[model samples]
Target: MKVVPSRSSEWVGPVTSQKRASAIIEIDRVSQVFQTSARKDHLALSNISLTIEEGAFVSILGPSGCGKSTLLYIVGGFVSPTSGAAKIKGQAITGPGPDRGPVFQEFALFPWKTVLGNVMYGPRQQGVRAAEAEAQSRALIEMVGLKGYESFYPKELSGGMKQRVALARTLAYHPEVLLMDEPFGALDAHTRTRLQNDLLNIWERDRKTVLFVTHSVDEAVFLSDKVVMMSKSPGCIREVIDIDLPRPRRRNELLLDPRYQKYIVNIERMFDESDEAGAPS
Candidate 1:
């Protein structure tokens, strides 16, 4: 894996902040191996290490089959790494917990539930009172632009609307970290762009540590504080590119900006180079 030089000297890998506790998520030498009956063994990740600071938005950028979703699932505690650890707030993640909320590509809202009920699900499950859960869910629903549609069922909503509900549901319980595996991947181009802006706006308000996994370089550059590139197959951090663009990023404005184009091109070049290097003679 290629190690990119730090853009800011003060921002070292381990000492990203003046205080060690500032690191909200720590992924140390994480590796995942699948031992299926059909295959002898498949190593999906190899020595993947990353440290994300508090309130920072980071993206894991790679081609398909690079274990991007696998890494995200590992951090979310849905899947355990073969030999390494994923920690948040100094505690090892052994299994799925409310502390880390996950938003998957498939909006996994219960079909029988209304939008309000779906958002309230997590908080209520955690033992919050009915009134309190509804209040929390209502606020999140509004934040994700689904305020008046609280009565609508998942079956009645569009893909974008469902994704909004999914996001609100994930954010209802105030998680310290958000793990999203291509949450907007299936949406149409226009809807995807709108949701991206909405997500950033929500992130600005909430300021949670977000780890987003996407294959699009443009999406990563537009949303991330840093774009972490991964190698093919046994995925590892190939490079970490710093995005120097200002926040409150808009799609049209950034799409026109030269710097944004440069970052996107640079990342694309890195992936192209990696693919060429990995190709057989």
Candidate 2:
């Protein structure tokens, strides 16, 4: 495994010459403000700027209320920033499009629809013929490890299975980027780990650009090429740490690897320091 240098928040240099040339998503000085019932302005994200290279798995790791999901939604074009802009492949993002797919923590599956029906919905909506859509959906369901459960409805599947269907549905339309907002957050520890491993395996096939938001340090370190740490509310970039571990990472091996352990320890320490810094004097 090669040692990779981490960059501070102030470091504006590109990750590498190759990545710099193929920047797939660009967020330029984006800020989000919301008005509370009390009539005060609440700033969620403050002047966040980030560049994600094509096929890179990037994790947005931050504390709760740090606007991590808000940022993800911005890139998905689900919400408009108060200022600045987000772009995909050089075009400004004005609204949600098939180019980006979002998988949320809430399974968001149609309880009325079975696994096959749910996964096929996206393609059918895109005007794909029913037979073709079913074929693609069945393949995706199998790829997500739900081969025999295609006919099962959301109510009949486990939480993990539901999430898998959600993932397949998102992938059905062939989005260029995957915006995953704590997609595994609702699962038990064992289930979450399994899904994490499964996600990496599926990701290895096509290497779709993924922007994953999570509060877990270990999860971020394990799944991402770069982990972008954010500050507390009115979140800003705190640091961007590049994971230098060799690819095709296995959970059993990574658990024993000193480098992986160090990354978790160091990131936790940074979060602790940030908390202390924000404590009232």
Candidate 3:
């Protein structure tokens, strides 16, 4: 078994590691305010600034309604921030582009399309030749462990299988950053764990920059290079902890590792503290 040192600290700004990679996504003092049905402005995120390095897997962990998904949406260019800005590779994000791909909790697969057809959609829309698109899609489907299920429709597959196809579809476009918003939240515990392991396997192959949002502390620590903790509703960064676990992490090994256990305990402690501090006196 391999061991690596872990560090925890209050996140003030960009990580100051000696080997800090270039920032692929920059969220500068971004804040989002939405007008609720009651006609009052509700602050979803408040002055949230974050920097995600290229090819890094970072997870945003927070309590429910902490604006984790809102922050992700800003980076994905799906929703504009009420204030501040989000940039990709130093360019302001005005709208959705191929550089960012999102996989949501909902399978979001086309019911009419087969697994192969769904995966091939992105490349096809990008104008790749049909033969080439099909070839690429087939490879992706296989890579996601859905090899023989190529012709199956979304309705015919299980929850885990549908999520695999959704992931393959996103990967087909060759996006630089993968913005996953609770992609496995809808599945059963067993299936979620399987997909989580599969996701890491596929991610290890390319190391694409990934921003994952999850409520699970263990899941965050298990999959991320760094876990960003956020405050309750009207979210703000509370801390950013570096997870220095060894690569090709096996769940069984990590479950028993002291360092891995420490990470989870410390994070859960922080959340408990946050909750206590927010409680009404």
**In candidate 3, what are the lDDT values of residues 167-269, reduced to their tens digit?**
9999999999999999999999999999999999999888899999999999999999889999976788898888878888999999999988988998999
Structure candidate 1, residue pairs in collision = none
Among all candidates shown, the one with the greatest lDDT: 2
Whole-model lDDT per candidate: 0.86, 0.91, 0.90
Candidate 1 lDDT by residue in tens digits, 141-238:
98888879999999999999999999999998878889999999999999999999999988877578889999988999999888888887788888
Q: How high is the lDDT of residue 33 in model 1?
A: 92
What is the alpha-carbon lDDT for the whole of candidate 2?
0.91
Return the lDDT, model 3, position 163: 97
Clash numbers, per candidate: 0, 0, 0
- Candidate 3 regions exceeding 4 Å error are 1-21
Cα RMSD, model 2 = 3.3
User: What is the TM-score of candidate 1?
Assistant: 0.92
- Of 1 and 2, which scores higher on TM-score? 2
Error of 1 at 118 (Å): 0.3
Per residue, candidate 2 scores C-alpha lDDT tens digits across 100-160 of: 9999999899999999999999999999999999999999999999999999999999999
